[model samples]
Target: MTVRKVLIFGRFERFWHWSQMVLIIVLMFSGFGLHGFHALLDFELAVALHTYAALALLVLWLFSVFWLFTTETWRHFLPTGRGLWQVLRFYTYGIFRGERHPYRKAFWRKHNPLQALAYLMLKVVLFPLIWITGLLYLFYFLWRDLPHASDLLFAVAVVHTGAAFAILAFVFIHVYMLTTGHSFAEHVAPMMTGFDEVELTPEEEAYLEKDQPAMIR
Candidate 1:
């Protein structure tokens, strides 16, 4: 077995990735505690911490947007509905039978069709909905005297809470999938080192024997 060190993640990218992970986890714990999940942190303190963490995440996201545009990393996430069916087929049937991945990673593109779609929805739709509604709910008290503000606040709160749960569910699924790489920490190593190891299985080896290079360029 040979270990190769590849450049996977850059310094700022890794910093943002790990820092956001920590902040999100902290926010989740405090947010849930505020919802009466054993009261580890008092309601007031939880609210304060939640707000702080949310703001930090928002700033991190802004930095990420700038980074993506500057580095052209946004190209990696370009949604491709054309291969949606094939991606589903691979996940549902091909992988189970030890088939090769239909999608290949390149310098300009990192995600498969399914991954792009899911990530796009999560960022463009789900995250914005959560952020907007949460902000409105957070400042509801400041507008309590306005007409119909009460009803609007309640509605926004419901949406915010619902999105929060959905985000949590996505996190669980995302973490599990992260481990489905060349090895247990394969996907994880990329985030830490900025380079992912692309391996060829026995099936792929047959094709490589015909002179097709297996390593990703």
Candidate 2:
């Protein structure tokens, strides 16, 4: 019960969060336009936009991966089963009954079990699939004359589109989850302000007080 206002996200983490969203959103819009699902942009323009945004996102992902591992923040995405069922149950049944969220926020584990699992899938599965298929699709010009090249290109496009849809679905679900918290702002304030009400051990409190006093309030 020793909750304190602690710095859970650093400056670069906040940049990664917001910039990744913008890049993905741009990719989605231009992608759908390229798919002929919309007429908002010209085909050539859509291609340029999508390609540039994808490249930017790729660079961001590379730096983010490095930062996460170097900062030991990657542990936050390691899924655990201990509270997974309770968190799932709360979302499915208890939440509608006005039950408070079952998980506590720890500075080391900002994401709950289910949230961590989702993020793990996105980072390891969905994102890789999207980028791989996208690169293959984009560089098709080099392989245009290869055997069954047309077929390969179509297959790549299908897989790339499917992965994009999966990411779009994730965005919808993430936004919906934001509202499930005490308040929408409560869920969002931590990332924006870099401070969150999280439980701290006595040792952690003492360490922050002595080594990084500004990180705690």
Candidate 3:
């Protein structure tokens, strides 16, 4: 079988991807350790490790955002109402038939409508909620000394814990989704090699030709 390889991820993009993965894994483990999930890492050490990893991940996220926006790569995340249903239906009912994905990754667009929406929510709501809430919890003791601040400790902890678990859920789903591609490493290979092997479904290809003139051959 012949496969056409298209460059999907840039060098810096892969760097950001892998680095963020390592940091997030470290943070998750350390954060859970701090919560006494197990006696692996002591509370103090876990807190320190979590904080450092969080900071690094936050910096990496910021840099990625800046790069995407400045380079106009942000278009990849534009949520499209038209293809949303098609993408969802395909994922829900089509893949089991060895079906091609309803949405195809193009040169100008890296994500499909569904991926765009999911990623947008992760960036705007999920990650920010986790970062902000976690930050507040991290500084809870220091801020508690301020008048009326003590009342927020419980609230902040709840938000932080909730966001953490939400992110963990996303991580689990994300990993599973990666396996849905042509091969177990089909999707992940692009993240490392910066190239993706794209195969389009007939229905989606026909739709693209009729709707997206620029994308039609």
Q: Give candidates' CA RMSD values in order.
A: 6.2, 0.9, 5.9
- State the TM-score for model 3: 0.85
Superposition error at 155 for model 1 (Å): 0.8
Give a tens-digit lDDT track for model 1, residues 87-139: 79988898888887677654345677888888888889888997888778777
| Span of ten consecutive residues with least summed lDDT in model 3 | 1-10
Query: Which model scores highest in TM-score?
Result: 2
Candidate 1 wrong stretches, greater than 4 Å: 1-8, 198-217
- Predicted structure 1, TM vs. truth: 0.82
As a TM-score, model 2 comes out at 0.97
TM-score of each: 0.82, 0.97, 0.85
Model 3 ranges with Cα > 4 A deviation:
1-4, 198-217
State the lDDT of candidate 2 residue by residue for 66-165, as single tens digits. Answer: 9999999999999799899999999999999999899998878998999999999999999999999999988898999999999999999899999999
Window of ten residues with lowest summed lDDT in model 1: 1-10
Residue-level error in angstroms, candidate 3, position 27: 0.8
